[model samples]
Target: MPATRPPTPLRTPRRRPKKSRSRRPRPPRPPPPPPSESPAVDPENCPVATDAEGGVDNAILLPDDPWTLNASSLTLKDASYKGIVEVRTASGATKRVLKYVISGGTDIGDLHQTVQDKRSGATHHVQAAKGSLSTITDGDTVMYTESISGNLLGLIPITFDPEHPPPLDIPLIYFTKVTVKQAGQFGGTLHVPGLRQYITT
Candidate 1:
């Protein structure tokens, strides 16, 4: 205990210059307000412009007269890229023109659907079957469908594209009951197919 004189070397505590909290330079965060042009939906004006088409997430089922899908069967399993569309028929005088080169993807779970009737030129085909397949019947999603003839009226109300950016649901339906192989008939051409999809999440 007589060596107390050696304790004088412990006075090296002079590091008090760390109070740098004057962070007033953080105002550069305002660049995020420039990405909204306002029309993520409801601006097609409606001449029969159903919805769900924000850039690359399309799903416009345009049903002004024939849109009955109470869920009999429609499963898509996630790889994205669905198909079924029929535009050009609202006073434009029936012009269902859809062409696809495919080039890749689309025989995974089955449902490559297509339908065309460009003023009776006639063209139809159907698909659905790789796992599940049934495709609606009767009623239950609210119930409303009765126009196999005359003055039709159904579907026509889907508008879902608020900028369409979510967690990879990318048109991933994954499965449907079964039966849709036209010509000789299996599903009878669900209004002549018009559901072109492209999901790659």
Candidate 2:
């Protein structure tokens, strides 16, 4: 072989590495929405009285009679205070009076003061025992009667204008129901009469 003087060093060709098509990155997923504050109330699982859309009636229940009560003249005996609250209708065709007795370990004077304060638009937080008896009249004659019982502290009666006449005969209904599920949460459903169904999940 003819001595080819040392062959010039061959130049290695540079090649770019292949991109990884098999390991493509995935797009990120969107975040979920926040939970609702007020849940819907299912009608089938709630009371009939709560069938109303808003779960309560907007109309105020005013007495049909006009009468006044003097807490000063009332007697607080046996840890209970007894008094009368009167109402009069605009047409003078109806009159209603509600007799109530609030009893508990607390003093009746304190209860009276509390009630008076509420009537005067004063706010005080105290728990007490309370009950009421509702009596209605048509043209100055007693027509209907009903009893009221509940947490005394939660019962706040708002007086109606003497020029406005409330319903002559209003229906009174009391209902209580409880349901327990295996789920790890508490929920409530209310079907208010003449209103929308409400559910809390």
Candidate 3:
């Protein structure tokens, strides 16, 4: 019987394949974008509007710096904050006020307030001997005006916290305008972004 090739030699079955030992590769993800930068605070580029009362009206920022006061970038007059006053009434209530001077920074400067000649429409000058601020006022408050040494103009820092919400000491600043009224018309306006904006971050 044709040597039936020696009885088929016994052979081991191939080992069972490991159940899909490998997995499908994953998809790649997209990279993140760069952070956005805020534009510099400028009347032209940023939000600058006048209030019904006029004077740098209010250079306010919203959504961002919802509490921001002053135009940190206000360089129009180049005045510096001078001092603060805390007012306590007979009712055990208190208030914080800020003072700004037209001149007398580092060395000595000529601080003048400018107002317009209502009838003549000519620019008038009122020297600012000094400046001061009363932090909380539901509306604009022009206080303690005095003549500038030798000028006829009346001077004082006109300030307001429209909302007037407060800690009193650190009230929510709204807008500030330093005025040098020659008589009726406005002479010039100064920037008062409040203490927070004035300070370096």
Candidate 4:
């Protein structure tokens, strides 16, 4: 009877399968903040003061008076030198010679040579003018005189590049001063007494 119980059928063993690994998603990153300072400063905004001769600061005289030159398109030749020349736009405002022009035709004579020459025998002499010239070239800074009584009208500076020729279409500069003519009745006219021709290189 014991041999008969041992004769039971043999049982088969079951095994569990291995699981596959998976990657998890990562969180997104935030953007960086903008820079505080500017990349570069403009040269016009930061005008440099120089002591060298013929320097822009030394040549250009900024008038202390609140008035300015009238430089509308009607008055100015171009917008490039609009703010270069400073003048008072009041009646009978006297402007002195600030610099001299070597090549261009200006009311002011050669000032650089005159300033350097101490000998009275020298024929070259510099004389000051009451009215300012309309056209100013690359190295010229002349005084501006205001003849008409008006508010701060405008300030204009006209420069000619040595490399380029004068514009045939438009006049270089035309300065207008309101004056009363002694006709039967008082009349007004724009007197551009100091219009200079375009000086070619």
lDDT of 1 at 166: 22
Candidate No. with top TM-score? 4
TM-score of each: 0.20, 0.20, 0.21, 0.22
Residues 51-131, candidate 4, lDDT per residue (tens digit)?
332223223333343222333222322322222222222332323211211223222121111112233433332222234
**In the order shown, what is each candidate's alpha-carbon RMSD?**
21.9, 22.2, 19.9, 16.4
Q: How many clashes in each candidate?
A: 28, 25, 6, 2
Error of 3 at 79 (Å): 24
- Please identify which of the two predictions, 1 or 2, would achieve the higher lDDT against the true structure: 1
In candidate 4, which residue ranges exceed 4 Å CA deviation? 1-8, 16-103, 108-139, 142-145, 148-201
| Error in Å for residue 75 of model 3 | 38
- Measured by lDDT, the strongest candidate is 1
Q: Rate the local accuracy (lDDT) of all candidates.
A: 0.30, 0.27, 0.29, 0.29
Q: List the residue pairs that clash in candidate 3.
A: 70-193, 114-187, 114-188, 115-186, 115-187, 116-186
Report lDDT (Cα) of residue 183, candidate 4: 7
lDDT of 3 by residue, 73-176 (tens): 11112233323333333333433433333221111122333443445655544332344231221222222112112211113233322222112322212222
